[model samples]
Target: MIRIKRIYEQLGDDDGYRILIDRLWPRGVSKENAHVDLWLKEIAPSTELRKWFGHDPEKWKEFGERYRKELSEEEEKEDLRRIKDLEKEHENVTLLYAGKDEVHTHALVLLEMINKKSS
Candidate 1:
């Protein structure tokens, strides 16, 4: 199974590789503070897409679709392929993002897409 959560969430008892998915460095989080196994910035949506959406709640649905498109376009499929390898070894994989709004963030869309694909 795979899971998604914000980096701010408690990490204890979370037993899987922790990967951060934001392109830019998260707000005030230090590298030491974030117990991340991988920071897959390469899988994040492009800068133009991020700026265009600007975390606007109104654009969330569209942003999700666009972000998913960008993910495929960015050749991040390789990472997905790699994650599958990890899944074979581990029971869960948590994709961590730093977005404040839990509902409208790209991470949710990505989690949906990834889980759907894995299924």
Candidate 2:
């Protein structure tokens, strides 16, 4: 199963195979404290798209669609495949993001894509 979590949350043993999905490192977090097994920066939304979204609730739907398109690009295919591979290997794969608005974050969009692909 794949789960989305905030990078600032406390680490737990159940959060198997934590993957940091943000293009940039969180402002206050350190590598040691992150407890991330992998950092898939490439899977994140493009800088332009991120800037456009700005975590605005009004743009959430459009942001997800745009980000999904980004994920489907040729260069990003490998990253998606890698995530699928990790899903098969781990019982619980947690996707960690730094965004304060969890509902509007790229991680949620990515999680939906991953789930759709897996199903």
Question: TM-score of the candidate numbered 2?
Answer: 0.95
**What TM-score does candidate 1 reach?**
0.91
Best by lDDT: 2
Off by over 4 Å in 2: none
How many clashes in each candidate? Answer: 0, 0
As for candidate 1, its clashing pairs are none
- Give candidate 1's error at residue 49 in angstroms: 0.5
Span of 10 residues, lowest total lDDT, candidate 2: 74-83
User: Residue by residue across 1-119, what tens digits does model 1's lDDT show?
Assistant: 77788888888575488888899888888899888888989888889999999989999888988888876753787777776677677767788899899888888877776777677
